[model samples]
Target: MIQLKAGQNIPLTGDVVRFGAKAEAALDVCALVVAENLTVFSSEDVVFYNQFATAGVVLAADEVTITLAEVRADAKAVLLVVSADPIAFPGGAGLGPVTATLSEGDTVTAEFAATPTAGETALICLEVYRRGAGWKLRAVGQGYVGGLAVLLAAHGVDVDDEPAQSDPPPRPAARSGQGVPAMTGPVSGEASTVAGAPLEVGHGVERLWMVFEDAARSAAALVSAREYAAERLDHELSLAVSDPATRNTPAAEEARRVAQQRNDELIATAEHRHQQDTEQLMRELADADQALPPALASWDSPAWDKPAVSSDGIRLGELYAIDRGPLRIPYCVPVPLNRPLWIDTESTRAVAPVVGALLARLLAAAPQRQALVDIIDLTGAFSGFTGLLAPVLNGPLITDHADISARLQAMVDAAELAELAHTSGAFPAPTEHRVLLAADFPHGYQTADAQRIGALIMRGDVIGLSTVIVGTNESDSADTTVATLSQSCRHLPTDGGTTLFDPWTGSAWQLDLDLLPQEPERQARFMRTR
Candidate 1:
């Protein structure tokens, strides 16, 4: 073991190294980066997700955090080699032991193992990524592109050079004495582009780079996986390795051998993480096994239990349907507000005759019927439905007439429950019948034509309908008749500016008299008439 102080950033030379407790500047042993919010972790080695802790650190270094969830280095010397930096090389290929949520200059210093004297700059291309599982590594390339795409797409990064297709900096050669090769003296395409201009980098060039990345990853993975499979297949187990007493006996030797084998296996697993890609290895292992795990097998297999789709009924949400309830309900005639219907007070009274027909309808909210029927009275031109009130945009905006009508109907239906509370002749129990007041409703919700309202009044349930009157000065014969009817019935103003006059007992006062408060003008007229 390399002898350094209790807390240091120096690289340990030997593979066999250990850390003590938190007090001794030793953190817990774990492969994943952990912090409160992101305890499990999204990406490891270098912390991501604006949370989670990085591995291998001194107490003071680890303790210093900017956010509640992450740690930061105080000294600028320690740094992470991210994908964006110009100085990336043998370093930034993967996450380092330390990470920060937002980008910052490195605070602490780091000492990497001595660089090998070998080949061209060591490459660290995008590998496998996390989609289904947490972060999983892709096997070195020349393999499955679709699988890799699935993994990396979520991170907003992809294994393919597709990302590089946008602008990327010139490739930095493995750090030489000449400060990370600058693109210019190096005349790099990514470095020399004019602002906002098309990035001078070409796809042909990126494809060439992919060729290298794909081959290298694939080759490295193949070698590592084959070796691991061979070693694991041999199958050995042991307990002790170096005890003298054990060395003497075959059983002892076997135990020592097994111990050595396990150690080798552990090393192999670690190597699989660093050298070959973990994803490729797992895929290879599964391939060797030939069948999926029971869970995945059942999952991937076709499901016959789900019901089949049908094209039979009215389409809703989508273009498909399945048999729902036992009631074989026939379609209702839809009064789609395809065109503009006048919506003034007068138009209201004119249409009242039609609405009167609906009075007998088994309004689900009938007990609260007065409120529902009156809600129509409550309606003033809502600005939200203004453009929508037009034939084109009408009923499609925030306050669709559909909703308006439905709410009015709902209020009436809800009143039904209240009506159940009282059996007074004033509020009759709605019968099982549904009423249609479309008589003379001319094509759509058009202006309240005298002929139209007249026809609906004669044929429809006049008592139940609502008659809307426009123009404060004078109303039509219908309005005059309704206003006169108000003499006998109970009239209550809905929350909206209008009031309802219901017909009741006496023909002399056919409209309910409760609405006396509703009309100051009529109250004045009564004095004049008297």
Candidate 2:
């Protein structure tokens, strides 16, 4: 129940065709092709230097597969592809050279390649008959479209990539001594393309007598060799067709399965490496201890640049114009605890609420309590109490006295207590670093605003309680201010100087900068202004 078709002649441009209700049948090897017969080459029009008349046919489409790229390379050759239909791929998926569902007529100049990514391979070719959706295939003929590509890969072509000379390199004439050859000057290191897709090449010659002579000689040479080759090819194909023992050989099946296993391993390795790289990038950003210098506002500029905080609020750096175009768009909701940010020190972009809770519980329970209490200015000392916290340390957990984590623990323990008794007058309160910072700085703030707030903290007279002044501003008229406290006030050397002046306590204050290494930048920045 099959109809004969006078299909359109396939040109050198290549072509396509749709099979109508083809009986799902296996093909016998010895049959000659007719107008009723349909066949597909494993690689169509494969020109192998006058070696054979044409390439071998697969006869069925769904038995094989091809890997493809989303965007085909505009390489030096003709890259031909065929597909059945338009297919959407996830994450901009890349498809290989295989054809999808072919339309009624089989010639297509527009290849329907649904590739996932750029510069990567996709499966483009396939065996025609398969086990799934009943979509017809579009036959692919690569050589017909773009033809051959000749590259001088063996020579020192790569050296051409270096800096070009003032005078162009000498080129061998395509035809020497009174000749009109097709080629011109020397090859620029760049690939000299022969116009179309990536495909096989043909050396051109124009003479009927010579062409016939060459063809005859080639055919004669092939005929001379056919007796030996045909015997081997026939024997191989016969073993595949006739002897069940040979046809069902375990070696071939094992080889295929082993190849499949190796391919799977390779793909898995690639994917794992990609994931690891991404995780490493995230870790670098999350664990930046002493990375780029914190952006400092010089006194001479007299204008505000928001203090550069990392993706989180830890050590502030310089505010560069990095977050441009898209990053400028606001993310989700505003964080409520903007002021006490200096204490949290967790990255702003990380999953924070859980860490915040863990810190709170740890601060309340760790046995080293006294050192934690002294760091905060509950008695009205330092100026940045209302500032937020960002994570400065996420080192390994160690219990010994000399361990870095333990050392950090001591400093943090002291910092936490100071946070509790100082600015808010909420003494003896549960010490969650995040909660304490929130109480001190109860709102969202931009980086410059945080710096301004830091400056205001210096104005604390009553300090930590009352008007809650942060910097040296004297004009704030708070009725129940947090900045007016007198007990915790003290002054030390103005950064690099030996002068001691207490703007808040108004007395001779003695302090050693070497003991508070954490505030060195803060000291230098503010001292320079004075």
Candidate 3:
């Protein structure tokens, strides 16, 4: 049998060959048929112990055998990799010191031990390939620190969609003098017992200790030598210093001065290197933080109110804003039932369709025929919501200036009556609510109508009478608060300044809104059933 060390190879003369191994943990054997260009055709071409459907490879416990019959003619070589895990190779955990190519018919056997400092987990254990009409076995002990997945990805296998797997942290760098003893001289040289044989005289050790003067002087020299060696070679060097009398000579004193100067230079170099490393680490940490998705810093804040479903169709959308992270802050505007929802359309043409959809959704979500809707489409942009509103529209669509005035006065009168009824406690608050949707307000409203409209906005919330005013102009009254929708799907209050509300993140984000689904038939059916 030929004993194969790492990076060794031998000729193969047979049609089939068997491999065997003994390991402390379970091992997986995989084979890849590589081409001249070094690219894999597909993930399916990789054969592992668990998936052995490849034509000529047979896998079993501790060994795998490859037959020559099924290897493709265009294949350059078969690479054999051994791993400890199924999903990923153990990075830094080494493998295999094996024997192979024992005579033509003999089986190959391999044994592997874990590394003292596992520098890699997955290793290219062997390679079987054609060598001019004959086969050859090569022991390739190259290891991958990133494991099998990384190795495969490097060769163009698409593993981007694979589930995230935890990777082993990189081995920490050894600190100065770790695991190494202070050496008085060369580690391989003969041992010496002379006290002052290893240290040079009179350079940085005059007062190394506070104890006995003679012993302290000797100890200081030794300490200086060790420090000098560690700074230069990254490990303490063993050296034999001569007697004190010998070291006190002129030549020794000069050598001591030179060593001290060199040691100082090394210290400066080390400090500079350390500063660079610290800066690099800080930058990497900052990049990692930026890559992570934003999250809430605290869930207990009052601004993070929970959202509630509105029975009336005035539920515009959820609000999203950014605080410590992206947060889903509730949109607290009470519409259709309480407050007037004024949507300013100057910034966005999409406001009309969005408002239409909101109205349709509210109508569809309402219980039975308890909610009423009236449309005054001054801009004639309510066609998107017309199918859903057709079944429940309170009156013929009002378009004239006089008609809008009359509608606002009627709502005011109704609200006053409802307020009187509510105060008297004659009956429970009415379940049926009226919604006035006045599209393109102020454009078709006279001064009298505007005053009436302002009054409705002021008292509509308390009386179960609400108005949705859609217009391009800003309202003059504080009671008529306005929310403007931008073309980018940013919802901005006229008074709220630059902050834009994102409905999806429930936070203030720069993201545009996703188009609301337009299901006219479903909405129409819902309105009819209600």
Candidate 4:
């Protein structure tokens, strides 16, 4: 076995180069094949056997092998990367160093050093490049604060810009052929100079160690389980043992262990409490589901006898009733232009279809195209209606929180324009009457966002703008329409019908809301024109 230090270059003697890390650590090995001009052909050129396509690299359980024959003839070199799972950092924040050595049958193995700290997540281990007509290997032990995604992003790979989730990327399948066993031992974090001399302690070295320590503590706090904490402690102590500050100080080791243990215990306790709360919520949903009536046969069922559309705007669905009486008068609920409508459901599944149908009806019934429609769907619950409302939609479907805020600011500007138009008696209103459909409330919104939405709901009527906010939970703002789905169809109140509690009058009304007709022809026609 050959011991390779960082910056040490060696000539390659084989066509098959294998990059492998210990299986116990669950590290992801990636090979970045770059052209001599330093430009990547495509995202696939950086291969790591995940959702992204691998170009010239072949994946195996313990290592990723690069076949020089399959590589583009014009390619300059390959940068081998070993990345820790950003979510868990299985062995710690950093990936141990990787060594390249020639094995029997002309196969080369790149073995990683054991991780030094629990905090190092991303590392650029080594580079194999073309030197004139021969290939050479150079050990470059560079550490990064984030995971594989960050490393890939640095190299110009366009990854999803959303917040990282807890799930780790899929692991590679086991290799079919066996070549050689990796060298076993802890690898050094420090890299050697190109002159084959030990690197002197410098500001860069001190800063890198500080970054590792900070990442270690942060990773320890992120996980809420005993096993994760213990794993972090093991990796941390391994580095601590080699450090000058904690190597001889037995008391420091004991203190760190005690603190880590306490943190684990606290995390476990919090998780238990959260589990109990979730169980209680589940029980409530189950009871509500049971109390709901049988599902309706269709949207056009005669059982929904009450007229949803009359002289007054749109009506909610029919009411729930225990007994039928001839003298009982059917109530028609109106969603007026100036007033905001709030619909709350007990079901976990989204009810955006129902909201979309109502908006379509209102927009279709508008006078001389005086009204326009805008939908702010943070949860993507209303994506199905994108085709139907494409013509009248104010902007693209909003999925980002920042975009929602910007939309609201634009609405505020429109409101100011509407006020001027109303005062000056302009021939046409500065802002057309708009019906904003907001679904899945409070899920992605911050406290400030909720307040801004509430203000819009309060003053919408005078500005000829109306909002229909739909959510799973109840809210105190605006008049509310309480509903529950039975057999995947909307069911309104029966006895008096669904209850509509008016915040303005402080009075409750029992009315059967009308179900709008699902006209496919009308929808297609509207989609084609204004």
Candidate 5:
């Protein structure tokens, strides 16, 4: 059987298919007959435990059998859904490790682990939809904290609007003292659960961010569940051995043993759930990383294995977590960056190569003529990159204090001219984006130079100008301008010691530096503009 990850789809070969979902907890398997617009036509379209069968969709025990040939002509797809059976788990339980399968007779053709986080109670496991003259199945591991009703409502089916018999009671939460703590990082069924701003679609980067948000929520939920379970176990054990009168009696010993056994079972279940969630997330991360364009891909990503290509965003680095196995979430900012970038040399490794990788990304975003690069390296740290990108340089590399000040003043003056031209319509807007790379900062910068640096950092984005400065992470040093710049710009430590906060949840994720390849030939191939 072929295993599938979330958002993956495959074509089906047979006409008669059985969609089965099995979990450690009892599940109410159901199917929705959705039209082309993704809405159910009537109450008869929703086939659940109460309504066993409808048209070609049938709920038989743990599986939903569908005769594709017998389905309604207007129906575009059949959605396979599963929710925790309220009758079996009255006090609420997670739908853990839901193994969904597609079978033709006794042969399983495809499978997916539609695992939800700790708080989720319902999930849309799979979808068998029309693909021209045939059918295709998709692994959709979207979860719902609000249970079956919410899942149905997202598909335009309101159980409350239907007849009384169709309205299933809302799933119950764990009763008081049942030891199940309130769930953390509540994941939504239809959209992102990232707390702050609604994620913007397109640009490819937002899609990756959505996937990162999913991984974050799943990881946090697992941690929260594990901690809560352990605490609950401790409390239960304490209660079990509290009686001094029967402390040494056989009954007390049995109670303690039972408590410990129950705790172990809970922990075991939690571990299994975490393992499944992690595996699924790793698959997703790998898939997303592999699909990333050259601009967003890591230095070692297969995307760079091929010829150079351009994309919508620039890859800053990636988020690293030891507990998350091999999963690496690529971090990206949009093409026209909103702020300057400060590469902290104190905390990162191989500062020159890191700068090279970033410059390469900026170059890849636009054509050679449209990408203007200006390098200032008095320390000769970027000498290798200077030679590799000599063909695309706007001017000679500035290596002296006088040249450094001249370049900064020139950029600041150009920015003012560009803004005036834009407002007066006297000249066409600047067609090219300028990138400034200043290495070993504060070495040649004076008090007046800092003001010029600050001006460029503030208004450069408006005039197609960007700055990448290298310096220490000293936000409170003697140099007030340096300290303010340190605090203001989007900063990344060269060694990946510090963390970058996610816009959605404000979670701190360590930045994994994207170092340039060690081979000179490889570096040339990547750095030299195509």
Candidate 6:
């Protein structure tokens, strides 16, 4: 299940969902059907203890159920709300901490916690709203000091002046003209949301990550719909043949045919919807790529035509599906990277281009003289990038084993000093972003060198340093320290294997590795700008 923090949101999976509330004391649960203006047109749209069901919303003893497929066409959102018992505690006591759960049948899909302040009597726990072709659930956690009457009046619901225990926090109020505050704004030129997660407006790297997340969600939804269709078809067919009286009969045959046709139609509809979603995301991706500040854009992106500026991330590659036609999303990771990057493969020639592209992107992400590089090639594996990076290197490229040891020791010391200064505030903290490009690792290194390398890999981000080590993990002994450190790094295969799992959904995505141009002039042109 996805645990949602306050102000976070995620895409819903199925049409029929249950929103349940659990608290120390019994709280009143309800749902309000609202329009795009976030106001209820009529009082009948409110589904609560008194009006138990309306517009596909059902409020039970402990939960509120919503059927997305049956919701009214004019409704834009369903607000899941929980209020404290005013009758039980008339002094406006808080609801303490309430946990809200969203489930599809028996499986819990997502959850959020709503903690009301001392005087707040009602809380808007979740918002199940229409987002594009699908729906999404956002953790609102918006509370009110004035009770359920204020909540209803805020959404334009007229209150009755009758005393009723069934009404949630019973109180009368005149209808209000105000609406709930909008929780989203624009990013770039479009709405600032990705897979229902709201984003900071105008940040290109965040936008890039958001687009990638959206594609992952879209892809996952397609797979789920297809599987559900197939399962439904199978279940219907089984029912048709289960009874011996109907087995092999004309009626059974007709049932099977109808079931198959419906299944095919569902699959087709799902595919069409998925295509629409993908196309929309692709357009957004293109817009985000064009706005990227040269650091997060692809090699051919228009952003590269402009001057390089400091960025918070580095674009490693593009993710695409081999079977899903032409949809491709840019994949990037933040820098001061959290994990060391391991360009893993056996072929020396295959890794050079990837390393070159990465170094170029990293250099472009930082301002002039702020990003430093140290290249160590024991077997001349990464000689191809030397000329391009010669002007910015910390020193001459070290090809000897002893020099590799000395370089690793120096980086370790730098990391230790920087980390110490950050905590102790006794010395001037290092401001430069150091990057180490070590190729042909574990070939000529001793145990002490490997240990030093391990320390650097583990604490690189904390010290404003990054490591892009090229080597194969397949042949390393699993029990060794080098193997342990290698496993800690983010492995990007240099061979033909391109599948990488997304952090949000763990969905496998095919990464199209960014390769630098082979022309010397083109490579030099990129370096000249830095």
- Tens digits of per-residue lDDT, candidate 4, 186-254, equal 012112112211211112222222222222222222222444556767766666576677677877678
What ranking emerges by TM-score with the best candidate at the front?
6, 5, 3, 4, 1, 2
Candidate 3 regions with alpha-carbon error over 4 angstroms: 1-315, 318-337, 347-349, 461-463, 473-498, 501-508, 511-516, 522-529
Local error of candidate 3 at 165, Å? Answer: 58
Question: Which has the greatest TM-score?
Answer: 6
Per-residue lDDT over 1-530 for candidate 2, one digit per residue giving the tens place of the 0 to 100 score: 11101110111222223221111122111111111011111222221222222222222333111111211122111212222111232332323332233222343322222322331122222112110112112222211111011110111122223221121221322212332212110122111223223311110111111111222222222222333344655554554446566546886555545555554554454334334433433343233222321211122222212332211111111111121111111001011122222222122212122223222222222222210111222212233321222231223222222332233244445445566566677655432222212111212222333333333333211122111112232122241132332112221111232222211111121222211123545433322110
Give, for candidate 4, the lowest lDDT window spanning 10 residues.
180-189
Show model 6 residue runs off by greater than 4 Å. 1-202, 243-249, 426-429, 458-463, 474-479
lDDT of each: 0.25, 0.24, 0.46, 0.48, 0.69, 0.72
| CA lDDT, candidate 5, residue 426 | 79
- Ranked by TM-score, the better of candidates 3 and 6 is 6
Q: Which order, best to worst by lDDT? A: 6, 5, 4, 3, 1, 2
lDDT of 4 at 298: 23
> Between which residue pairs do clashes occur in model 5?
347-495, 348-494, 348-495, 349-494, 349-495
Off by over 4 Å in 2: 1-248, 268-289, 292-530
For model 3, state the Cα shift of residue 203 in Å: 80
lDDT of 3 by residue, 299-369 (tens): 12221132222321222432332322222222222224343555655533357555654464444333443
TM-score quality measure for candidate 3: 0.35
RMSD to native, candidate 6: 14.1
Q: Against the correct fold, how does model 1 do in TM-score?
A: 0.18
Which tens-of-lDDT digit does each residue in 1-530 have in candidate 5?
87665544556888899988888887788999986445687889999988999998888876799999898876768989888744454444567788999998789988988667645678888889764467878776777766787678867786574321133322323323342222111121212223222223223565565456555544454454556668987887787678888778898778878877877786676556556656765776566567666777656668767765556567777776676445567766666554677887752235887898888888766553377788878777877767888777878988787888888888889888877777788757457778988777777777777788788877776566767888776567788877887666667765545444443233345667787776888888677565
lDDT of 4 at 420: 65
Per-residue lDDT tens digits of candidate 6, residues 26-117? Answer: 88899999864467869999998888999789988779999998888657689999987566656656677889999988899888876777
